[model samples]
Target: MTDRDADAALDRAADEALALFADDRRSSGDRRESHVRRPQRASDVAETVRWNVADWAAADWGGPVPQDAHAADSVSNGASNSSASDSPADGSSKGSSFNDELFNSDPFSEAASADRPAPDDRSRQPDSSPEPNRPPEPNQTTEPDQPADVPNEAPEARAHATPWRAARTAAARAAQPLPSVVRPLGEALGQTLAEPLAALTDLPSFDTSAMDGWAVAGPGPWRLPSKDATPEGTGTSTRTSTGTGTGILAGHAEAAPLSDGDAVRIATGARVPPGATAVLRSEHGKVRGEGRELYASRHITQGQDIRPRGQECRRGDALLPAGALVTPVVLGLAAAAGYDELTVTSRPRVEVLVLGDELLRAGLPHDGRIRDALGPLLGPWLRALGADVVATRHVGDDPEALHTAVSASTADVVVTTGGTAAGPVDHVHPTLRRLGAEQLVDGVQVRPGHPMLLARLAPGRYLVGLPGNPLAAVSGLLTLAEPLLRTLSARPAPPPYRARLTEAVQGHPVDTRLIPVVYQHGDRACPLRFHGPAMLRGIAAADALAVVPPGGADQGAEAEILDLPWTADGIGISADTATGTITGTGGTP
Candidate 1:
């Protein structure tokens, strides 16, 4: 059958089963009792109920059963007693209330089960002997004694019973589509390439000297006559030397242009005059008659000390591809290539709003008011990412003020710190919803920044809600802010490096933990002391954030976390073997 038909069939079957159960509960007066509890063996019940609506959903849809499906099954099967036992006086007349709750609790369970593979037909059913009078024993064998050669439990069965696989299967089945791409580079960094730039001229356009010396003739055996040599001797000896130094040669008596045997003094980076082919250093040459007369101690060849034109880059070549980031090095290269201005991607504008009435601007805390940490914290971080902070406003916890601030800002990204929780005072979440923002990550399974929210305000505009706590705000920025910046800038996602943990860390099994850490070497990373959302001091002191992965319940487990450097510019980790010093490169590592 088609997918739709299969899904409808599964839904109908599940509804019928639920309807049958509801009818049985209504007809029977024993409302407090569990469903199908008779002399029926637990194994028989388990086998009969194993492939519930979720299993059918798995078979119909395509993947393994979802976690929520199991949760829904547990709740649906367990809630029978509570719902059935309620009397008319107790206000339990709403039969659909229990179904509604179960349905709402897990919307995808039925769909997930329909997607899963069908159960094996070879499996035999267990005997149905009721054990309602006796308590269920843990890990009890219910199957009849079989042949010694035939194994009761298959290895595959044992493997399929793991929770991790179930969770992974559920996660895979419930995967959502990736968000649409927007102007990624423009939002984060203010700089963008106007067009693809090609080199107009070669680097070091002309051949230049690299040393302070005399540019002379070819490699040689030089015979220098005395400066006071006889006129006849001068002519004969000079003639002999002239024939040997046919090319540009050293001067016999004084440093002069090559008339026959001449050498001109040239400094480093000085242009080599015509006829000059090699360089003879002053230190290596002997000055016999005052400083004018010189003799070469070592031989040299042509073009030995010259830096050739176009050695680094050629003219008319592609210097930087279009859409490449215009960094300091790129700017320098462009300038060196004789370009005055570079056309780049436009910088994305960002506006920050700090919301809360309890936030104190500065000075000692008065009464119950705390100092505003977001203004001092996020502003510089945003700027470092190349975003132009158009405005920063501190608004009270009033939803109207927040709406006003957000509406007034013309920035591409509007970041609001505080009031994201479910408390009565929390208003950011509701305000964002009212503004028609599409939530990306409603609430990440993370500590510190658990309340952090990501939403798209417009095509290119984004609204990021940060937790009110100082550390939580920072964590939120690292997790979402940095990624948003990169997306806005159109920069590629950075690759991660492996680092050994210096100390053991413990965390909740459900939440992903972000710990402040300092990378000692390029490979060794250690967590900083005193790290938490409320602790601003610890965040300020941290060099990089070490991300502890999800499921960190065990101590001493190695974590693979994104390394957020202190500076938001880029990854900065420098280890000097000579000095044994570690430095961050100021970006995501």
Candidate 2:
């Protein structure tokens, strides 16, 4: 069959299907009213028309329908008016003996021609009727039965199971360009630094006294004769005199520059007088002779309890370089170093798109709907990873709506929480293709998030496709979101840790594994045995996600694991040493 023919058929089928469904709703409403009132016979005309149109639509483009190159140009006209009595459902039940004849002698069979035009033909206009509310059609083909919601399950899961590979692939595919370097410090909290930072000034720029004491000018071991000292002794006399006098004074009076034997008192932060090199505590000194005499119990060292100029840090030194994650401590240090502001990278903005028709915002399903947990689940997770969510929206399983939402977002990263499967309503993959996005990783080998897709829309712009399931969405966010953020920030991927598996883990032989687990010791993390992507309780209780090798291994086997670090500050392997576990020291075990 031609692409043109297929396109025409699809267009007609879609239009007819939409109209038929609308009429069906009207008929159904009429029947309900009839039941409420007196019993009345309702014409089945609308039902037959709805059934035929729906059946035709499902057969044309619903699930895995092979494309014909020529069907694309077959026709641009709308559906033709047919007699409502010719319902496809009636034909199936009453004409069972003629089923083969109808199937073999189908008039639309020739519609699958090879001379189809491209999908973007200006002559084609989409059917305007809104999608009908209907249950998914049951699989009627001869193909093997697969999970209705997730069809490409096993292979995609296996592809994304490797964290390192997935991380690298995601990073490579992330198109968000590195932002300009001149962003404000407030906005750069989570961004990577474009350049290194140097200290602007020396901490403690001037010599300051650490304690309130007399700044003396004399050699060590200078003797203060007890006979002439005050009752409080030499140290007390010195302290008292210095407190009273401006500098050093004579004859226990307030004056400047005391005589050799005279003592002056001083307060905390008071500058020491010239010729004074040591501080003797008042408690250790003795005073005698009506406060005229003072004596020291011990010798004092020079520069005692004094902060020298440029002690903590020197001017122009590299206090903190660019690309370093700024913590509160870092901010404090920078402030102390006399920097009013800093030049840092800018944090990437993200937009979360939740896609599905069966998903409900809240409450129980009145029809066949289910409450959506992806939005609530992913918003916090992305925020925890340091990505700023500028906006979040829920798009029902409509391809055009999904396209519009994604196209309108100016965020660096766009995450779609569902609609990645091949089901009729699964529109993410096709919508992305329509948007001119370059697919980096179409599918990964991993559990729960195998259908995840990573793509680049433009420079500094990324799109990550997540499965419709809540757990799958989370897994995709973790596996793909991490690297995408890093790439935008220009940060390197964190290294993996070689952890000893405390419990045996079973996994597919061909796929890499990601098992959510908890670390016991500070450095040595052991895998928590129980896990399920769909079960939020177990994942919530987990401390880390341990990566098991492709094949299953026994307990005590050392496997590379990615540390979730939800509660920790840094990433990388925790080094287990003989003394203590070391982390964030740039060492690996």
Cα lDDT of all candidates, in order?
0.52, 0.52
lDDT of 2 at 107: 16
Candidate 2 per-residue lDDT over residues 219-335, each given as its tens digit: 433333233334222233333442232222222322244345455455555544444566666665665555444567777776776567688888988876667766666667777
Superposed model 1: Cα runs more than 4 Å off: 1-195, 219-261, 553-558, 566-589
Q: Write the per-residue lDDT of candidate 1 for residues 1-589, one digit (tens) a residue.
A: 8645554554444444444433443353111112221112323332333344332222111223333334345543553433323333112245646423221211233333353232332123333463446543332233321111112112222222223223222322222212322233322123545567788898777655677655665443333334434222112222222222112122232222333355544456655554556667656766544434557777677676767778888988888776566665776777788777766555557778777777776687777676766776676676555555666677776777777777766778888887766556678777878889876665555555666767777666778888777777876776677667665655444566556666544343335567666556666666654454566654455566666653332224455656554343442122223312112111111
Off by over 4 Å in 2: 1-167, 170-173, 181-187, 211-216, 219-276, 279-299, 360-371, 570-589
What lDDT does model 2 reach? 0.52
